[model samples]
Target: MQARLDQELARKGELIHRWSEGSLHEVDLIEEDYFTMLAALNRKVSSLRESIASLEGTPPPRVAPEELLANWTAGSLHQRRAILKRYLHSITVHPPLPSSQFDRAPLVKTRLAPHWKTAAEVTA
Candidate 1:
């Protein structure tokens, strides 16, 4: 949206420059387009400000283990680390049992605050 607004502003500047240079013969049509573009740019800026205001103080929503796993798999190393650090205070992983596959349950432990509930916890 910001990029589009910037492009429109550049077009408006070009229009004015052309009008000042006496190259544009259709003065009335160009004037109408300039004002319409200006109004649209103002509306875009106002909408962005309102969106920022709405998100400014709000906490992010919690995610389930499945969603977390999906994000973890798709994220970069830094992003994955950030997610781990944000959601867990501490984690412990035990070695797999002999001749058995690795199991997340009964081996891994996480310490999250009571206020930060996962989606599964909330639904349960």
Candidate 2:
């Protein structure tokens, strides 16, 4: 990413140099492209910094799947729902097929949190 950012910055610099030399045409288009690339690189760098900071900081608490499952099974509906909300990004419900009965396994698509994935892998 840093290499890509450097290459893009160089290209932007070249564009400016060409403009200064009066050899480049389509000033408006070039300027727009330059600003767009700059903004995108800025966002990428900021996100990268945030990711680095998060990884460098203390790790999150690790939970065993069995313990978590036990808690989930013991919890009330509201508590279970809260746990799901905490660990899952989204749960999409698809419509049943014409010939099919209500089967939740195929009807629901769940996206889980990244940390939960890591925890599961560690336990595995």
lDDT agreement with native, every candidate: 0.51, 0.51
Itemize residue pairs with steric clashes in candidate 1: none
**True-structure Cα RMSD, model 1:** 16.6
What does each candidate score in C-alpha RMSD?
Answer: 16.6, 17.2
Please write out the lDDT profile of model 2 over residues 81-115, one tens digit for every residue: 75676575554454455655655575443322233
Instruction: Single out the weakest 10-residue window by summed lDDT for candidate 1.
Output: 106-115
TM-score for each candidate, following the candidate numbering: 0.28, 0.35
Strongest candidate by TM-score = 2
Give the per-residue lDDT digits (tens) of candidate 1, residues 19-118. Answer: 5576765655564554455445435544654454456744323344774664465445665666666655454444455557545564433322223436
